[model samples]
Target: MGLLHRFANPGRFLRLAARLQPWTNALALVLTGWGLIWGLFFAPADWQQGDAVRIMYVHVPAAWLASAGYVALAVCSVLSLVWRHPLADLAAAEIGPVGAAVTAVCLASGSLWGKPMWGAWWVWDARLTSVLVLFFLYVGHIALLRAFDEPQRGYRAGAILALVGAIDLPIIKFSVQWWNTLHQPDSITLTGAPTMSTSMLWPLLISALGFSFGFAAIVLARLRAAVMEQRLRVLLLSRGNAAAGAPS
Candidate 1:
């Protein structure tokens, strides 16, 4: 609670974010560029899938960011509900659009990857369908956040929706195991040795880190802008009230 309150100050957060953004942005570009080059050109082709497997370099990262971004959104929602953290609402508002974009990339890349591997652009497979649902959840959260004229009301409504939608995260994770899905089970697991070869795995991990950094960079930049905008609005409103109250 002490730590949360310390950083919850918008001005303090903006200063910290400003210092971190350049480093994150640079790392995102360098790592993503290097990983893509290595994965697309240098990584050995799969014995079965061959060159088509290159798409994993992009699709996998986007898939990861989509889920991870939502987790961040859900965290913000919790902070907003529990602590009434000032910055959390602003963070959630910014996260929704970015999360949606990442999810869209995941879905589009999955479709393109699927067409060659599955002989169809899409299937109603459990993993695929659940990810689609995740995308809709992002979209709905984005819309709900803006649905009310009063910002606080909208934030509260969106926070509840985000919390409710988070139930899908675990379902998305275990969908392949739980159902007969065309999507493959995870090759990488925290508890077990990765099934993927090091040649592919190294680049994939690098790309995922890069995407993670990129997502953080984007959200921080957006949050900073939002905080500044809110400050400006409040200043403007106070000035208008002051003038209206002044004697003519």
Candidate 2:
């Protein structure tokens, strides 16, 4: 808890987030834009899919961040529940919608990719179904946070949902192998070199990094705003109580 204690102060974190947000946003925009351009033009087209294969650049990274964002939310949920860290609640609240938005993007892009490749805009393939469930989990997390009247009550409920929803992440990862699916097997694997050529892989990696930085920027900005809002609420309530108690 020592490491956690150091970062417990909301004011300190807001200051740090102010310093970091611009840089992360800039990095995200530049890298993601360049990657898209490179992937669409310079990277060699897939022999099988030709120009349509470029959709992988966006779809893959959005899918990666959707899951990664959920993992972060789950970790924050645990911290909020176990340690009662104020910042942890703020993190879960801020990150939930971002995860949901990215998950939507992932699904939309996957559908776009599927139309030409599979001749269907939607399918019940194991991998696709798992990802769809992941999207719903994100939505549930967001909804749960907003469902309660008291802020802390909402946060606690959302945190529990986040943890339970974490079971979906592993399912999403292994669904391709656990059952037959139309989605291709992993092109990049842990035990062996990536099957893709360097030309195609490079842009995808760049786009992933870009999206990651963008996600960081958005999360930080949101966290800073949430901290400030809570701070303002505290000040207003304190003032109201003082005025009410004074010589009435």
Candidate 3:
């Protein structure tokens, strides 16, 4: 309750976000720039995939964030529903479209990389199918939230759906292990060292980190905008009510 009360003030959040945004944005730009150059130019190409492997620089980070962003949305949704934190709903709402966009980029780029390597634009492989489902889940969440006339009711419903859909996240992660698929196996894991050389792995890691922070920064900005808009609407409504009630 205390925490919620403290953060509920938009001015506080705006101040914190303003301070953090520049640092996060700068880090994202530097890391992304270095990662792309290192991955595309310096890292040795796969013996079989050749230069096509460079696509991973973009595809891998996008795919990772697609899942990560949804998890964030679900968590924020839960917070909003349970604690009724003012910014939580706004954060979740702002994050959904961004997550969906990342998922779309992952799929589109994967298909582009697949056409030459896999001989088709897409295969109904388990990983691909699960990712597709994840994409649909994002779309459904967005549609459901907007469906209701009352914004709070819509947010509540969307939050529930987001929580439910999060169960698919682990399934997507394990799809490669559970079923035969065209998508390659995970390159990095907690149990063992990454399969790639330092030269290649470092850039990929940098890019992943960069993309993650970039997503966070964008979400913060969007959430701030949402909060301001809501405040403006409330102010306008109050003004209207006051005008209607004034002495004749």
User: Which stretches of candidate 1 lie above 4 Å from their native place?
Assistant: none
| lDDT string, candidate 3, 1-248, tens digits | 68666878888988888899899889889888888888999999988999999999999999999999999999888788788888888888899999999999999989989998999999898888899999999999899889999989989999999999998999999998988888778989998888888888999999888888888878878887888898899999999999999999
Better of 1 and 3 by TM-score: 1
Model 3: how far is 181 from its true place, Å? 1.5
List candidate 3 stretches off by more than 4 Å.
1-5
lDDT for position 112 in model 2: 95
How much is 107 displaced in model 1, in angstroms? Answer: 0.4
Estimate, for each residue in 34-145, the C-alpha lDDT of model 1 and write its tens digit: 8999999999999988899999999999998999999999999999999898889999999999999999999999998999999999989888999999999999999998
* lDDT of candidate model 1 versus the reference: 0.93
The alpha-carbon deviation from the true structure for residue 47 of candidate 1, after best TM-score superposition, in angstroms, is: 0.8
Candidate number with the higher lDDT (1 or 2): 1
By summed lDDT, which 10 consecutive residues of candidate 1 come out lowest?
1-10
Global Cα RMSD, each model:
0.8, 1.0, 1.4
lDDT of 2 by residue, 64-171 (tens): 999999999999999999988879988998998998899899999999999999999999988788889988888887888888888789889988988998998888
Q: Which candidate is the best by lDDT?
A: 1
